[model samples]
Target: MTWRFALVIQPAGVDDDRRDFSATFRTIDPAEPALSVGELSTQRGDGIFESIGVVDGHPQEVAAHLDRLAHSAEICDLPAPNLEQWRQAVARAAEHGERRGEGVIKLILSRGVEHGPAPTAWVTASAAADFTVPRTQGIRVVTLDRGYASDVPDRAPWLLLGAKTLSYAVNMAAIREAKARGADDAIFVTSDGYVLEAPTASLILKFGDRFTTPAPTGGILRGTTQQSLFDHLREEGYETAEELIPVDLLARADAAWLVSSVRLAAPVTAIDDTRIELDSGLTQAFNRYLLTPRD
Candidate 1:
């Protein structure tokens, strides 16, 4: 998590002109203490964020990430971020880096100090970790009960399920628990035995020639990487779908992957104590497509 560059953003209103908002971005020392002790983002995790993958000097899927950021803001009741301002901010931060092999750009908007004037926003760029082992050799996973039904999102909007909020204590704990249980990652399953998603990635299961991910309806954050892969797969003439996947379906999957912005696509070699075969050719193809620069 070593940041190469950071920028503090004086976020503009949704109606602000791009030319006027460009000056609001200011580069800052990544190691400097820039946050107040009373910031709600640090105190109560009251914020939303998006992470965009960078290849060479290009920021991938900028429009999709910004769209998700706005959606998260709406769900969390934060101010509507001016997309143009954030777009320029992301570009500025990305350009501040070395523009080498792989990197990541993160856009964060917090609720600011507890009773302060306005929200706090910033962007950070960092070199992405080498995921060659996970991408090539694959990873082991375990399923954990998320303590809610698949319909919890519809039944409890206040939970802020689908939004990519900063409140990730539970998600981190889940990953730690998985590691303690002798696995590399964890997949969240509904109390009623339905597949959801990973703590930090989206789940995609393949059955024969068809690929399916859990429907975004079940408190699952819609994955930008998964969507892009789906589009690519469709272009390649492969069948893809989003559906309510049952937990038992994992045992029958021909192949599976956990995809994210930073790590790209990682094959799942085993689930729980059951060994699942890895699709090497497809995995390589997925990573090849993912590593390429895409807007």
Candidate 2:
């Protein structure tokens, strides 16, 4: 699928009103080299990013995404982003892709090269047809070991365990291994045998009218999409809580889902080749609520 992307570099200390699109923002050719050869984000994966879903012509949950991005950047020790500048860039990119239907806007912040004092920032909007089938048909996921104990983040601050940084080689590898094993995705279980999260999404387990997910304090990145879903569920008379989930709870859940910004929510029909309960009715409700604009 063809993608429409916007790449903008706003130098630090620049006023938003004085910025020039012609000079600062470029419509990137996907086939061309987008980053400098010396870029640390490429060389060392030292960056933070956020993927926001764009429906129709508007970016969904932009403020929440930005807040998460800021937190990630802060955790990565990068300079604070100019929210207005990033917002403008995201809008330009999302509009460029909206004509083709829904898409995703990715905001990337990188630690500049060792020789440079400024950071690098860019946004891209890409076609998102990949989620169509999985969202409707549900997905099969396998449980994988994350190799870190549940309480490791509390003891190791420098590990940056909870930050949504660009260093996702392990997460990518986990998903690849799951796909090789005939599953669509993978959920990460802590070394201590607790449910943590998924490679690219958050895990939510449903039992009747109650929903439970891992608390962010357990070193998981705070899930903006999952938070929105929990809020909606609460309003709909469902109970929700953030707690440490045991790996075996998958067998008890009436339904389970992997949720994120672009894909929204995909019900887990099977885990590790074991068939689990599927709640198409609840899954449909989640999709409707997620795709609907909040404001």
Candidate 3:
């Protein structure tokens, strides 16, 4: 896997490095030591992250992602991040990887070391592989129980249900289980049968001319990509909503999708073993909508 580290170089004699803007990039050596054992994020999943889709050097939905990242930090009780620093890093990474046409800019923030007050932050850029098979051909998904009720987030703040934390063991495991079962991905449903979200993406359902997704209060991470697409759809005169949706309703819906930053919008062709209807035209339209540069 090729990786590039974004480096920000301050101008000579610039006391306030925050305002400086010269970006430098270097290839990251995989064999080099990148982290210490004592880092809290390495010792424990004590961090938050954001994966921004980069197209031709520009990061889509920059402000929205930063806002979400800030919200994640607040939820994790970490110090307020230097937003300017993150922006610079992302810009540097994007510039470095622009030649690839499309890629991902990953921003991470950790709670410093095990015994420190500072925080660890960095950005990495890599060319995104074409997931056209899933996006164009659609994907088969299995429904897995998230082992938590829909009301868990409202009742228990310590669980960090709504926050986009770095602890993705369960999510990855669920995907692995699905793959083992001969499926492409997994959709996490609540213990009570409410459809939640995919391991790394949000779920959206379409019925006739209406569109809806699970409410964010249901212990699901608020999806930035979904929200961006929703805004675009609403402006185009489509009926959009966010409400609690039962898993069974997916079978009756006109169509369904698994959307994310990098993957954009992918049609869900099957849930478990049952195949659902796929609107090839609508899916293509959604792909165009999502990939279109947002202003």
Candidate 4:
């Protein structure tokens, strides 16, 4: 397969077969050009976005992912994106990538690329590389001292805690530091000592006879897989609960796992130098169910 070129073109409404380059003109020179004035000033106006994984031609829990995007948009004070329209855009982006057998989809909506402080909106979808295997090996993670930074506590600045947003500089920095320190991922805990979350996913623990994860109110992003696991566990005679787990609790738990759209459910085999002495019996039980999802 010889690679040719990647072109970013055809907004949602464009005629795909017409090959009309005239209507779909480029503003900033793809090679080098200055961003428009509005882009510079209105970058933070208001927007909603989403990222979903297309595996074996399947968009894993796409509906759940969009619900989260809409929830995050509302939290960010952004205009609600048309749900069905966005869905189609993701499908198109996934299809555009020939490797639809397995890949990632990124959907972004920001203030319209036009000028002024207007509440305009735009959407862009693109293919992404797949990196789902490493997450299964159980990523090495580090804990951060700062409980996620927030502007106003009353607004529950941590509301964005779980919402996946483009504003992820801090999370990236944390991951960078972790990699610098030869670790795989990072975790942050609230000052009160409750385990907050991983840089990009929700945290959970597998204790005796139970599957425990933090509740949304715990300032953690609502995890779709974790929710599925709850349903999965309940049917298998296992109990699930959301508790304010002490950040340090992970270090003491029987076993720890990071749950998200990509990883699904990955065990934290270790925390720092602390070897997670897991009670595999429970994991074996869950694995049986996971291997053949009821869905």
Reference-based TM-score of each model: 0.98, 0.93, 0.91, 0.74
Candidate with maximal TM-score: 1
Winning candidate number (lDDT): 1
Q: Please say which candidate is ahead in TM-score: 2 or 4.
A: 2
lDDT of 4 at 293: 23
Over the stretch 215-264, how does candidate 1's per-residue lDDT look in tens digits? Answer: 99839999999999999999999999999999999989999999999999
Is candidate 2 or 3 superior in TM-score? Answer: 2
The global C-alpha lDDT for each of the candidates, from Candidate 1 onward, is 0.92, 0.84, 0.81, 0.59
Better of 1 and 2 by TM-score: 1
lDDT of 2 by residue, 106-165 (tens): 988889775887888788788776776788789999999989888898998888888888
- Model 2 is weakest, by summed lDDT over 10 consecutive residues, at 13-22
Model 1 CA lDDT for position 139:
96
- Off by more than 4 A, model 1: 1-3
Pairs in clash, predicted candidate 3: none
State each model's C-alpha RMSD to the native. Answer: 1.3, 2.2, 3.4, 5.9
- Candidate 2 — which residues are off by over 4 angstroms? 1-3, 11-24
What is the TM-score ranking, best to worst?
1, 2, 3, 4
CA shift of 129, model 3, Å: 1.6
What digit string (tens of lDDT, one per residue) describes model 3 on residues 70-177?
888888998776666677667777766655467888887888678875777666778777879899889999999999988788888888887788888899999999
**Residue 43 in candidate 4 has what lDDT?**
62
